[model samples]
Target: FFWDRGGEALFAVNHLARRIIEAKTPKETEKSNNPKDTLAQEGLGILIDINGFQKKHIENIHAIAYMMAERARYFKSNIEIDPMPAFERRIVHEFLSDVADLKTESQGEGLSRRVVIKYIGAI
Candidate 1:
């Protein structure tokens, strides 16, 4: 699905679509022979976006993570980010994975889960 704008509403719709798709998907042994079904099963299903909003959102997330890392480094202490979805948290972790002086971790539960940038000292 596509939209002219994407924010909380778009996010909610995308999330709902994902949940519906997952609910309707068949089990491994009961997989369909159709090529389309195969593609969906392989995670190549329809994409929901709003004029490249997802890409822009990812960039924003990366920017925030970078800033947080800088803050942690400067303060020589751990910094906790505001809660975000698992997908977003993963982005933060992966983006900072190669930074030798920082460690990223997820804390809290469910919707409260967020990334924490821990200062591990310069290498």
Candidate 2:
């Protein structure tokens, strides 16, 4: 699907998944050692570039996740919903790409946050 017509979003998300693994690999390079923090920042910049892909460019999943979680669950019920789209998720993706769990197919509110956490970790 991506090859035929998919734009940068697909590729970005795919790169994102792999980057997550890359983030973790460095941790293993030396149990006591850590990956260059800047690497995470670089990865984050790449992820931030993803934001350039507005909802108009990507899948419906993001929108659906927002509506179902924020509207139906969070604000509607005051139940705290999933608090998905976890800020930690995106920041981690961007800044702490290594820590990402590879659950990139975030459903409800999880997408925004996971993606955000990854981004912040990188930048």
Candidate 3:
């Protein structure tokens, strides 16, 4: 079920099947407000999921992984990335898990938490 708003307090909850509409109102609302962000989000979403949020998130993960892989190998030292949510930190850890010379760890607490990639020097 989805809510269709015509005005303040003038909305109806209607059932919708994914086959009926490729994009849901929630998906549209989620990316609304900022045109630049919406475009980027939609472009990325087309590559992955219809929501776009997941695709953009995955892109962020890939970007962080690329940086970590390069820095951990070249500098042979630990690198700290910007603070991210727990799920995002998990993505980084999982993405780098198979990297022979790279390892990921989470540090800090609450909203200040972030991931730290360290060069483990080949197993």
- Whole-model lDDT per candidate: 0.85, 0.38, 0.65
lDDT of 3: 0.65
lDDT of 3 by residue, 1-123 (tens): 111231212111111232223453336546667665555445332222333445565687879778777987899999999887665787788888888888889999998999999888877
Those runs of model 3 whose alpha carbons end farther than 4 Å from true positions after fitting are 1-50
Candidate 3 displacement at residue 17 in angstroms: 18
lDDT of 1 at 98: 97
Candidate 2's displacement at residue 96, Å, is: 19
lDDT of 2 by residue, 9-69 (tens): 5555757866775666444334443355545434433334244443343334444334433
Compute the lDDT of residue 108 as modeled in candidate 1: 98
**Highest TM-score against the true fold, candidate:** 1
Using lDDT, give the best candidate's number. 1
Whole-model lDDT, model 2 = 0.38
Off by over 4 Å in 1: 1-6, 16-47
- Point out the higher-scoring one by lDDT: 1 or 2: 1
Local error of candidate 2 at 112, Å?
20
